[model samples]
Target chain A: MKYAYYPGCSLESSAKEYDLSIRACCQYAGVDLIEVPDWICCGASSAHATSHLLSIALPAKTLVQTEKMGLHQIIAPCIACLTRLKVADMEMEEHGDLKKDVETVLESTYKGSVRVRNILDVFLNDVGLEKIEKTVTTPLTGLKVACYYGCLLTRPPHIAQFDDVENPHSMDDLMRAIGAETVDWSFKTDCCGVSMSLAETDVALELTNKVLEGARDAGADCVAVACPLCQSNLDLRQKAIGNKFGVFYDMPILYFSQLMGLAFGATTTDVGLEKVIVNPFPVLGAI
Target chain B: MRNKLEEAKNIMKVAVKEDTTAFAKEIQRKCGQDVLTCYQCRKCTMGCPMAFRMETKVNELMRAIQLGLRDEVLSADTMWWCVSCETCATRCPQGIEIVEVMDVLRETAIKEDYYIPVESIEAFHKVFLRSVEAYGRLYEMGFAMDLNLMLKDPLKDADLGPVMMAKGKLKLRPHKVKDLKSVKKLFENVRKLEESRV
Candidate 1:
């Protein structure tokens, strides 16, 4: 199976492990992800927060490329990027003038035909769990994980609709398929304070603290995530959150892709496991 | 805790400061969310994770907009505090797309220069857009530096820089698109569109 890929800004930078593992997982699934050539930024939180037209137009520029590639679906690993692309595509369809405006802005015609999906959607629907189950060489039998969706994965119900808006389980189900024990937790769809991370660091830290505590309380060994923002907030800032709250959580916040890679016969180094901030090796070693 | 009754009285008193639907109509035109259909269930407020940080509750903000309380709504730091998690939008029985409403409010506040956001939120968005306009994708290094300059802090994230660098996570260069001319043109067209809307 072939699909278009938008690595997004974070995937190429801070969230490189996500990119590495997602690519590794897709390769094992026999799914070829062709990068959308000359694809621009998806306009992320910044575009949507400031300019409505810019939000639609910037992502539309990327969607226009997907359209030009004649691909039906584009895999945006970053949930924010996926949402932006999905929002832009939906806006173009919902509002006729907006589509014309985007066309005029980008100086390119967009068919609004690309289905913007996260990598989870690709694995869950396209590649099927049974196939993935059959391919698992290393069953994550002892690994107990809290599947954290964060936000934008199943939110803004009018747009970016993927799974249950409040209680999504695609990630959990995927974890189970790979032989990992999925813990039921309330903070699965909670916000990791998002863009406020850089600005209001404490607030983000507090939210991250809650998620980590919740996962731990619910008997999860580690937290599995889909979005880069969620990973950075929960993983990158764990120690900081610990420092502020005075409660150290050695909990590992791992990308679901990395876990999938681990089960799909890839080495820990190949999936970039050692790159996580909280040192997942300590926890994964016991498994 | 402060008296809820007194706060409600103050909110109402400030809300009547401007009784014009023109602002409401403009919001309807610009944001395109069905805020008028709100029955004040406060589900949005209840679902909002950042509600504690917001001066105006999410549902109250929607109600204020509906009642044309432009000044009260715009000057409030509620929109700035919004994390855009969309839990409010997701759980709203009215299907009001509250996150979109918050976006328009922030955009309006910035454009009209009504209430300057004290937080580094404005600087963050500006730097993010500038990075995209320049490189077609966010350049983390440049974004961090530009953010520092805008926030009047040269070495704010200086410590985290080295940590990120050692991990081999921070890409030194910005992500660039081949058709940068198109990206420039897109920004130009958006500016023109905004001017026309104004």
Candidate 2:
């Protein structure tokens, strides 16, 4: 199966490994990810913070482009972008005046012909767990991973409408399919502070620490994240948190795609596992 | 924590405006203007990573806002402590932009000149605005140094220091955008547009 793809800004830069893992998984899954032409930033965490219209317009531009291309479903790997796009879709569908107002600004009408799905949705729903199970060339035996949902992916159930808002099973099911253990953790849907990680390090640390500590305490060897921002904050900020609190819990935060890749017999380096700020060496050795 | 809570309450009492109708209206769309959906679930409080770091309950702050207890909402340490991860927003069944609501509360508090440890974050915003205002884009290095100096915490920048040092990325150099004059013009135009719209 093929679908249009929107790899938001973070995929292009901070989480390049996520982009790599997406390509690798798609290769194995037999899904063609056709990039949406002339896509702009999804007005990510900051744009919506600054203005309401820009947030809608930014994602609407891509939605309009998707409609023009005759594609019905688009896969956004980034959780923040997925949320923004989905929220925009909900705003337009729920609020008629907003749809008209946004349409006027773009000077083009959108027909809501597109559905935004996160990568987790694509693998679990579209591709089916049986397909994923078939591709498990190397089952990740005895690897414990904490599935971090990171708030945006399963919120305002009416908008995201992907999984159980409180207790999501899409990631867990996918992880189980790949032969990895998923932790029953409370902070799965907790926030990693996104842009605030950059502006407020202390705040970011506190948030990151809670998630890390929760996962660590829950007996997870590593944490699997679907969002790049969550990955960055958890993986990259660990050093600072270690330095800040004198607690060094070296948990390897893996992009969910990386886990899928490992299950499919791809090597760590092949999935860009070495690029993570927190060293995956300990877990790698354990495996 | 009790002393801090009393301090937070005292501070919020003076910080939030006595009249909250307009303030509430502006944020009503965010929380769906439904102030009654909160059944004291405390889901937000339990899951907030920074909740313990802060002195007050996020649920308490929302309840205070819903009750039109403007002084408490404004004065409480909750808004300032909010890291805006949207954990609360995501969990809130009433569909509150709890983070955005916190922003409005903070911005309102700032406008009212409520006392806060504003220097560090304020500097980041100032540097952000400066970059946007000057170059029509953000310059990471320049903004980085400006924020550090503003906070008077040179040690705060240690996180990126090592990476930049190893990669030879942290140069004490300022880079200007191409067509530098046009960037300045762009900023001016943007400012003018924002003012006119307001």
Candidate 3:
């Protein structure tokens, strides 16, 4: 299978591991990822707030680009990008005025012909869990992971429509396919306080701590996520949270794709495992 | 306690003064959902895990926004209360992205120099930017202490002292992030861009 891939900004820098691991996984799965050309930032948490038209236009620009490639489904790995792009598609489809307004701003036409699917949505929905399960060569037995569905994925399920809003099974099903155990916890859909990380550390710390404690309490050895922002909050925020809350939790948070690569018998280097904020060595040692 | 009727009246007065209607209007323009749809359903409050300790009412926040009660809406502690769970955003009948609305309000508050648990939050943001600037990645331990100090809540350190002692995890000596100059340079560039944008 081939996809028009949108890795987003974080994938280029802080979360390069996510970019690498997903690429490795696609290669293993015989999936082709065509990088979107001349793509601009999706405005993430910024553009959407300032200019209404820019929010839709930014993603629509990419959609127009994808249309040029003749690809209908684009595989966006970042949760924020996936949310913004897919939500744009959703809003454009629902509000005709919005489409006209956005088109006027971009001086281009968008027919909403393309669809944005995050990695998890594409893998679990299009590729099939059975295909993933069949490829597990080194069964990641005994690795207990917390499945984290960052706020964007499931909320407004109609736009990000890949899983249940209250209880998502895509990541869990994917984790199981890779031979890992997923904890049954309610915080799976909890917020990582990503946007609030800067202005509201106290709140961000509390929320991040909740997910960590919830995962630990639920007997998860590590937390698994599909979003780089979620991984940043869960893994990178630990030290700051430790200082604010006075608790130390060196929890190893891994991208779901990394674990999948592990289960598929790929080495840590193949997936850029060394790049994560929280070291996965201890966990890898145990495994 | 202040009279509930008088308090509600006063709240309305302040809300109007803040032009919260404009704020809500801006959000509606962006999100395409009527901010007025939030009829104090409290589903957002019910779903908010951290609502137990917050000083503001999530339901009233919506009302403030709809009424264009700008001052009340911006100043109300509810702006700080969001954990960004998106639960309320998810549950809204109008499909409002409540979390995004909160973000917009926060940014607006900052732009207008209104009020925002800013001292604490700004400090934390600075710490994060420092880390990102230095390592091109977030370093938790250093950023955490810096943020705590910024909060001026010295007790944060005192509270952690015992826990750190118990776990043998506290490092008395802080480590400068590797390639500190490069990180400093990065932060300098980011600040320059941010300054230019502002």
Candidate 4:
């Protein structure tokens, strides 16, 4: 299957491993990811939080390019990017004035025909669990994973429209297909206090601490996430969380694609596993 | 019980004005979310992850907007702290998208030049958009450097720089899209539109 890929900003930087693993996993799954040329940032949380017009225009420009590429479906690995793009698409479709205004800003018409899919949707729906199961070269037996769906992936259900907003099972089912045990956790779809990691470190730490503590309490070997913000808050800020709370919990925060890459027989380096702050090598070795 | 009834009677004695509907009408026009549909249900506040950090809770913010408490809602730090998790929107019994309401409030605050209670987040938002304006995508090193320099906290998240660099994640150079001029034009158009509205 062929689809357009919008990696967004984080994938090129903070979530490089997600980029690597997603590419590798897609290759194994026999899916073609055609990168949208000259794609701009979706403006993410900052744009909508600041200017309404810019937020719609930024993603509208990219969607215009996606349509130019003749791709009907596009997979955004970052949940935040997916939400931004989907919001733009939804706005353009629902409001003719917005579509006209965005087109004027973009200097191109937004057909709103492109279907935006997160990595989880691409894997679960596009590639299908049965197809992924057959491709699993190394079954992740005995590995208990806490599938953290953070916000934006399935949230504001009407916009995302991906899975059960409260208790999403797409990630869980994807993990199960790779022979990994998905742990039942309460904060699976909770907020990871995004962007606060930069502006409000304490609040971000407190929120991340809760997610980590919840995963640990639920007996998860590590937390698997789809969003770069979620991974960064949970993994990069773990040191700060431990230092502040005077509690140490070295739970590896991994991209769901990395685990899928591992299951598909891709080596650690292939998936950029070394990049993770809290290493999952020990746990992987044990299994 | 007598005191509560007296307070209710006193509140009922005050006349509602056309100005009270101005804020609610503007919000509805901007985001298509009807604040009037919110029936004082605290479900949004209860589900909001940042409610504890907010000066005004989600439900209260909704009520304030419905009541056209422009100054109260605009100056509060609640809208700034919202991460737009959408839990509030998803769980609202009335199907009101509370996140959209927060987005509208933030836009109104910026447009009207309201005194932002949380300046750092506002600063980050400006710096982030500036980076995207320059480069089609976010330049992490440049964005963080600009943010720290603006916030006067140069050493903030300084420790993670080397760690990220070692992992080959932090790029010193930005990946500008091929059509940089078009992106700039888009920004210019947005600026013109925003100015026209003003």
Residue-level error in angstroms, candidate 1, position B44: 1.3
Q: What is the lDDT of residue A18 in candidate 1?
A: 92
Q: Which stretches of candidate 1 lie above 4 Å from their native place?
A: B1-19
Error of 4 at A207 (Å): 0.2
Better of 2 and 3 by DockQ: 2
The candidate maximizing lDDT is 4
lDDT of 1 at A77: 92
Tens digit of lDDT per residue, candidate 4, span A1-287? 88999998999988999999999999999999999987899998799988888999998887888999999989899988998999899888888988898988888787778988777877887788999999998999999999999998888888888889889998999999999999998999988997888877888888889999999999999999998889988998788888999878999999999999999999999999999988789989964
- Candidate 3 yields a Cα-based lDDT of 0.72
Candidate 4, DockQ to 2 decimals? 0.78
Per-model TM-score on C-alpha atoms: 0.94, 0.79, 0.75, 0.96
Q: Which portions of model 3 miss their true places by more than 4 Å?
A: B1-32, B35-39, B49-55, B65-71, B74-84, B93-198
The CA lDDT at A220 in model 2 is 94
Model 4, B1-198: lDDT tens per residue?
Answer: 999999888777674524687889888888888998889879888888898888888888888888888899888889999988889889989999887888888888887899998888998899999999998889988998889889899999999999888878799899988889998999999999888877
Stronger candidate by DockQ (1 vs 3): 1
Per-candidate DockQ vs. reference: 0.66, 0.17, 0.14, 0.78
What DockQ does predicted model 3 obtain?
0.14
In order, what fnat does every candidate score?
A: 0.81, 0.14, 0.18, 0.80
Span of ten consecutive residues with least summed lDDT in model 1 chain A: A153-162
Q: Which pairs clash inside model 3?
A: A240-B144, B15-B69, B18-B70, B18-B71, B19-B70, B20-B68, B20-B70, B21-B68, B134-B183
Pick the TM-score winner.
4
